[model samples]
Target: MKKKKAALLIALVMSTCTAIAQQKTPKAVMDQFMDKRFGMFIHFGPVTQRGTEIGWSRNDQVAQADYDSLYHEFNPRLFNADVWVKTAKDAGMKYLVITAKHHDGFCLWPTAYSDYNVANSPFKRDIVGELAEACKKQDVTFCIYFTVLDWHDPDYPIHNPHDTTQSKGLGGNMTAFKTRMKNELREVITKYKPFMLWFDGYWEKPWTTADGKEIYQFIKSVDANVIVNNRLGKVNDKLDGDAVGDFLTPEQTIGKLNMNEPWESCITICNQWAWKPNDPMKSLKQCLQTLVTSASGNGNLLFNVGPAMDGHIEGRQVKRLQEMGAWLKLYGESIYGTQGGPYVPNETYGATRKGNKVYLHIFQRKDGTLSIPALANVKITKAYFMNGGAVIIKTDKDNYKIELPATLPDENCSVIVLELNKDAVNIPVIPVKA
Candidate 1:
């Protein structure tokens, strides 16, 4: 009886330790990921040939038979991994996430478990492998985007975005599906050595909390250092909690000022996630502000760009990214390695800080002046424009005003540096009028 009790205690202790291990990521790894602040999200596949959205277009916009067979002619002869990685690097991106497998169940790399992979396609080259090598050569971190829901696989329960006749989580071999998923993920982790796994398509009823926990633990067992996003379980559009992953991923929008947790916003450069001819792209001003706002809110930005069928990024999009790189070259000090504000961000301006210096990012001004709530305990010792000019500062009892020049240095976002008397990070988050 005593032996049985001792065994039960040992089992409980081991289970508790495992749970704790799976829940937390290494601080060093988390810090490194957050410090990057910017990355490239590549959403490319056979769907690029049809000029439709990847995965979701199957059985909706395009016939399932036709969409599934597009891989036969998926020959991206111009797809150069070097060019892709270089494009990201030139755009001041520190990392890259390519879609290894989307909801269509099409795999970019040759996987033993799936016949619907790059090996069978006319291109016949390992897209993920090449990208991984290219990222390494360019000194950029390589990551993978794997979706949890496979619409193409017989084992996976969900299918047909437009088909209401068939219900999810019915008539599918979930056990076999999970085994295949584990096998493919194991291959991805051991072979590619990705720094992170960006998961999606987990909100469907087919995937559950238990499944998410299992997959999360499985990935950690393979590589404890690799980071996972919040989509490993059921999460709302805002990416609020109750999930098993390393960080929060707020898709297509900037996350709120959240200094307590790590988050990254995935937004597209264009309207579409996959390439389309003559697609409208965001202007340089819009792009720069998106990045700046993300940084000002204490979050990272994973800006997406979809390569065309010919495996080249759109020239116009590339030019816009280059413009952003030029701006970052001048004012990157305000964004990189800095934590979000002593003062909470508002419509007119936002703030970021590192050490004793506070960077005030003025997105707009009224009558050549920007006003924000006054800091309670910190004193501004010196103030200057990040570009190359002096700034006039006037402080009242409740608020402070920064008088701007007639012609701002940067039309996209003008940055002002404020040297504080104490460590800016030590100051509590101060709310300002919107």
Candidate 2:
């Protein structure tokens, strides 16, 4: 009887230890990712030469034969890793996540596992290596974006109609495919030792929860400190709490406020993820607002920049980023190293908190006064504009109001810094009227 009891206790202890290990990411790595709320996403591939979307334009925009033949003509002599990392740095971005491999199965780095890489192109340079070195030099975290669904791989279970060859179908050598992918990933991790692995295109037919867990474990084995996203096919950005992977990636969309899990909204500066002629760009104000919203929601923003065929970010796009950077220079305090909330964001504005201060981000300008519901217990000590000017604050039992400047603080989203008596402010949830 004592032997059985000892065995049960041992089992319980082992399970508890396993659960703790799985739940906790290396604090240093997770803190680095979470603290850096803004990052740069570079989506450059051979498809950019045609001024079309990567991977998706196989048939509609360009013929499959033409698409496959792009590597022969691929040349980005002007490509400079230093300039790429500098662009991100100038924009106040703390990290960069570049496409190591897109769904087109085109690898940026020369991979022995597959011949479909930049090594075969006219460029013949290791783009990933160059960029990783640049990022390290610039004190920027380097991460890679890898896609699981491959249109070029014959072993990949799913077949897009645009592909020149059809797969043997669902029962295709999935085990071999996974092995090849893991091997390639091992090469990347072992070589570059990336800050994080941002995965996408896992919503395919062949991928399963078990596959995600296995891949996640494999990555952990390689570098226990490296961060991984939730797109490993096990969980998604929507599901929080016990979701597998380090962070949630809500592609092209901003996450809701009060998110319990770490998340990032990957959005494009222009409409397309790849370079195209005359592509409309989001305004400087829109860009800052997006970052503000993401921070207010306790999430990160991986703003994407698609480099041109010549490997240069367009002058117009560069100008927009610099303009946004200028704003961040002045009012970045409302963001970086802050936690979201104390007030749920409405269409009008959002809020972020740091230590004993709560920052109210006013999106829409009000003439005389700006008011929002407040927690009854917490006291608002003083209020002032982040850029400049002091304001009178009034607090009632259930609401707080601030006096606005005659002209709103810079045209974009103006931040009002409020000193709080305590570190925590509970923002009471108010139900929406349908």
Candidate 1 regions exceeding 4 Å error are 1-23, 237-241
Any idea what lDDT model 2 has? 0.84
TM-score for predicted model 1 compared with the true structure:
0.96
Candidate 2's residue-wise lDDT over 1-434, tens digit each?
99999999999999976764565467677767888999999999899999999988987788888998899889998899999999998898999999999988999999999999999999999999999999999999999999877878888766574543443446567788889999999999999989899988776667777787778878877788888888876568554553568777887888877546788989999999999989999998789889999988888999999999999899999888888788889988888888788666766788888888888899886568777776556767777888677878887655677778777877788888888787753544333334
Taking all chains together, each candidate's TM-score versus the true structure is 0.96, 0.91
Model 1 residue 286 CA deviation in Å: 0.4
Alpha carbon lDDT of residue 389, candidate 1? 77
Candidate 2 accuracy as TM-score? 0.91
Off by over 4 Å in 2: 1-24, 161-171, 239-243, 425-434
Candidate lDDT (C-alpha), each:
0.89, 0.84
Candidate 1 lDDT, 1-434, residue by residue in tens: 99999999999999987775556669899999998899999999999999999998999888999999999999999999999998888889999999999999999999999999999999999999999999999999999999899999999877786777667337888889999999999999999999999999887777897898888888888888899998888864333456678788888899889888889999999999999888888998889888888988899999999999989988888888888988888988988888987777767777889999999888775677777788887789999999687888998778888888887778788899999899998988886544
Report how far residue 257 has shifted in candidate 2, in Å: 0.7
